[model samples]
Target: MKDYPQSVRRKDRQETDTSFLHEILDNAVSCSIAIEKEGYPLIHVAFYHFDAANNDIIFHFSKHGHAGDEITDGKKASISIYKYGRLYTAAKAVDFGCEYQSVIIYGTIRIIEGEQERMQAMSDFFDRYFAHIPDSSYEAFTAAQSKPIHVAKLRIEQWFGKEHALPAIATDAFFPAFPSVMQPREA
Candidate 1:
């Protein structure tokens, strides 16, 4: 594995463990991919497969969509996958923060065009999300359903992982504000 460029802003929070990076990718249900097009940055949420074997990510987009139109082979893109954690509060406003594990990947996108490879990538994607189905029927089903889908592989050139955590000590009579997901609902 090659060394990724470190973020000078938060050197302490950068994560290097490859296992932790895989965990974040495997556990995430969706990712945000940012692509630059004509001086504009377009970000879209997509369902992706983390190919640990190839050290890349694969995803599908609708044919004739903005992604298919804007993104092509060798295009540069950035991917972000994250897991949100609890909010951390402090007596001082500047100290307030939140816990999170996130990874940013810089890569060149490759559009899988070969019939065999495209089908295989599509199969891998379906198998990841639909593991319950047996392989006997998977091939036939995928072949029939894959016609309208376009698959692209993001070949990871570099990536950085970061995690922010609060020290395990209580502040002086301070109450931490909970995240919206953790807050109670109103009747």
Candidate 2:
């Protein structure tokens, strides 16, 4: 890992364990990439595969989309993956809190060039999301190989992880019930 500056304000919540950080990266449902387009910032969320061996992330987007036009080789970007849990209610509004785990990575994007490398990255992506299914059971991967997509890798240079877990069950402030949904309002 590169020696990047640490600027986390809350040292108590700062997570420095490598294994825990990697776990978040591997299991998070989606990641958000922040990039600059035409001097303006843009964020794109997508499913990604965390390449632990290479210390990078692999993802793809439509070749015809705005992301395809904005992202380029050697472009610097920031990627963030996060998961949130139940809300903690408190009598004081300022005391309200929510459980969360997050990992932020700073890196440069590399548009994959070689056909073999691109194919391998896509295969790895498919496997990450569909590990429970047998490889022979689905033809979607095979079919998607011919699609017009740009498979790119985010080479991580620096990363930081932080988490705030819910208080113990003994704490009455933590809401243990399932979250209720809001009903649509009629005009």
- Predicted model with the maximum TM-score: 2
lDDT of 2 by residue, 1-187 (tens): 2454575788878888989889999788789999877777878888999999999898888888789888889888889899887788666666678888999888999999888888888888877787799768866655355468888899988888989886554234445565445856557
Task: State the TM-score for model 2.
Answer: 0.84
User: In model 2, which residue pairs have backbone atoms overlapping below 3 Å?
Assistant: none
User: In candidate 1, which residue pairs get closer than 3 Å at backbone N, Cα or C atoms, i.e. clash?
Assistant: none
Quick one: how many clashes does candidate 2 have? 0
Cα-based lDDT at residue 91, candidate 2: 61
In candidate 2, which residue ranges exceed 4 Å CA deviation? Answer: 1-5, 167-187
TM-score of each: 0.80, 0.84
> Tens-digit lDDT track for model 1 on 1-187?
2454556368888988898889899988789999888788888788999999899899888777788788788878889999876676577767767778998998989988888988988778777888897768744655557777788999888888999876554253333454466687767
- How does residue 180 of candidate 2 score in lDDT? 48
